[model samples]
Target: MGMKASYVVQPFELHRKRLRPARQEAAQSESGALKKAENLAKRMPGAAALRIVADDETGELESATILEAFGEVPDDFAESLQGG
Candidate 1:
């Protein structure tokens, strides 16, 4: 059976808007995870630098799943970081 015009028009009658999370909720979101990690890095300079390797695709990756590639920096690495 053919659909009625009302059915087709129903979608157009609606207004869609993006919803941003509240400050507390946003702070808990994944986007905030990176910020949190950076703050942690500042406090724990001796701690391993955050390193995460992900295969291209979709889905979630846990914190423990992320690779922690850190340790002895090359002599030049520090100089390079200082932009010299």
Candidate 2:
């Protein structure tokens, strides 16, 4: 099977002041993706968190947090780092 590669960024959303995860975005680079997330956070006054995620088709993934008002990460984020 062919390998897949992509960079992603997601911003946390706030509804009624509740923290929640938002949709994911595909980006050209890690910095570019984080920039997008940052912009999203700026546009969203309620944005609670942000993460830059990178993944390969092989199920390998990595993530970093830019804003952690809540200091939280994805549930499966650690699993992604395990050898596939």
Q: Tens digit of lDDT per residue, candidate 1, span 1-84?
A: 222110000000112442211121112333344455444445333112322222335323222221121222233433332352
Q: Could you list the CA RMSD of all candidates, in the order they appear?
A: 22.2, 5.9
Q: For residues 1-84, write the lDDT of model 2, one tens digit per residue.
A: 344544566555656766556776667865566566666766654222334444545554464544433233445543443532
Candidate closest to the true structure, highest lDDT:
2
Question: Could you tell me the C-alpha RMSD of candidate 1 in Å?
Answer: 22.2
Clash list (residue pairs), candidate 2:
none
TM-score of 2: 0.49
As for candidate 1, its clashing pairs are none
Model 2 alpha-carbon miss at residue 9, Å: 1.0
Q: How many residue-pair clashes does candidate 2 contain?
A: 0
